[model samples]
Target: MFSSLKIRNYRLFATGAVVSNIGTWMSRVTQDWLVLSLTHSSAAVGITTALQFLPMLLFGLYGGVIVDRYPKRRLLLVTQGSMGFFGVVLAALTLSGHVQVWHVYLIAFFVGVVTVVDNPTRQSFVSEMVGPKQVRNAVSLNSANFQTARLVGPAVAGVLITSIGSGYAFLFNGLSFIAPLVGLTLMRPGELQKGHTVKRGKGQLREGLRYVKGRPELIAPIVLVGFVGTFGFNFPIWLTAFANTVFHGGAGMYSLFNILIAAGSLIGALLAARRRSTRLRLLIFAAASFGLLEVLVSFSPFVWLFCLVLVPVGMMGMTNNISANTTVQMAAEPAMRGRVMSLYMMVFVGGTPIGGPLLGWVTDTFGARVGFASGGAVTLIAALAIGFVLVRVIGVRPKMGLRNGMPYVELVPRPGSRAEGELASAA
Candidate 1:
């Protein structure tokens, strides 16, 4: 589980990433609160979220093309610096009392711009730091780092927002970028593991799309993640509305709720790190379980109960995320990894533009409960629908079997099929 950390460069990368990730989460919480504080409209908040992710939706695949064409380490420096600059500008505006919802939206849009390049580069960059053999563990540990930061960042942001104001949180996040920058500079390039990079060319983006489109195993999970990401992952809108309106709580309560979920996610990530293999079927079940948990949590009568339910919700959600991410990263050819991952990120996060406002509208018009329930129902339906498709298109056949005296699912693939061969080692 801790195997990847033994690599000196990855150790540096992970250390720096943890610090920066905390700041990232801090900015996320504070940014949403700031937008809501200024506008008092969930739709306005959704707009900010949409602006932050829109660039990824539009240009993420192209950014992946760039990642494949350039040295990821150098590319990261530029993108990370750009994001931190936006953080600082936003902080300065808020500190001077000149911040507006529009200011937040503009800055968020620019930050999203940088993220289009940064997210996929950083994801695929892991291959350069550690070999494919350790990719699964490294991915899980990377998520563990992010979740651990989530546990700390939001709770701290809530206190900071209530006490020092949101400006300080943004400023802290801006300054925190220095850690990763320093880590990158300190890396030993000679010791790094290298992956394939592409040369400049036309139709490269189309090539990546065609690559995934041709693989049913690949397309299946990507589509399922799209639904889960667009609908099921609209927790920011729902959680904020529920904490403030339904539960009648302030930043502290909101922070506590986030903390509980992060704790559960941390547990799930660590457990995933212990796994020797990942499977698409596990991802399916985890996503379905996550949707069910969300449905249950959305209807919690009390805040404490809601928070308790969030543990399993976060757990299954993280499991689905980590498992799918590992599978996708492992499946792609190294040369096309950037573009493929860019498409994955594009679907996963870029769809926020559509989902955020839709969910926000559902919250504003109908109430947060209906919005949450609707999102979960959609997610549950998506999982079922996609699972059926995978069975039919990929020729998945299932049988009941016993393992350690416990009944388990056994997949019997069609004889002499591509997907059947892929499924043999998919885990």
Candidate 2:
């Protein structure tokens, strides 16, 4: 499971990310609580969340193109620095008591803009640090490291918010960037693997889309991620509202919710790291399970019950994510890997912008319960739709027997045993 750490550069990257992700999570919890406290409106919280992810929806495709054309390491350095600056500005504003909802929204938008470029570059950059053989392990460990930080970050943020202020939490996040900056600087240039360079030409984005358009195994997972990310995985947006409105708890309860989910996510990532294959069927099952868990949690009457449900929610979420990521990376041709992965990131993260506000509006208009339940229902429907689409489009059929209480889809290639050919022809 820890096989990727055998590489020195990845070890450094992983170590820095562990620290930085903690700070990132810390800032996230504080930011959400701060916004809610200031505005006392779920709509404002959703807008803030939308601002943070809106760029991914608008510019993510372009960002993928940029990741394909540029040196990922250099791109990361610039993006990371930009992110740190935003953190500092947010901290400064909050510290001065001059911060308003619009200020947070603007800063969040700025951060999202930087993230539009940063996210894809960072995702694809992993393969450059560790070769393709270790890509799966590296990806799984990356999630593990982030989720591990998640567990610590929110717990600490809760205490810190009760002690110091939200500004200090933001400051810690800003300062946390230093570790990654130093890690990047200290890395031996010789150890860095070069990423794929795309030929500069017209219709490059179209070309990348066409590439994914022709792969069922790839498109299937991407669609599943889009559904889950857009609807089911937005616990942060709704959970904050739920804690405040439904549960009548404060920031502490919100923080506790995130901590529990993160703990579950950490375990999920570690378990995924042990897997050798990236199966599409596994992704489908995980996504379906994640949706079902969300539905169950929506009905929970108490904070403890809600928190308990988060364990399976986190588990299924990480399973779906890691499985989708590994499948795309392993399936793509080396030359198109960067672009393909960027497209994947675009779908995965980009969906949040549309989903966040819509769900937020649901919470505001109806109630937290309705919002949560509707999101889960949408996820279930989307998962079922995509699963059927995959079977029809890929010419694959689920096995007659149930495995793990879910229908198992087996890849059924045409007579030539060329699934790609079948997919391309169908497309």
Model number with the top lDDT: 1
RMSD over all Cα atoms, model 2: 4.8
Candidate 2 off by > 4 Å: 392-394, 397-427
Model 2 alpha-carbon miss at residue 16, Å: 1.1
Top candidate, metric TM-score:
1
Model 2, total clashes: 0
Question: Candidates' TM-scores?
Answer: 0.93, 0.92
Candidate 1 segments whose C-alpha is farther than 4 A from its true place: 397-413, 416-427
Scored by lDDT, model 1 comes in at 0.87
lDDT, each prediction: 0.87, 0.83
In model 1, what are the clashing residue pairs, if there are any? none
C-alpha RMSD for every candidate: 5.1, 4.8
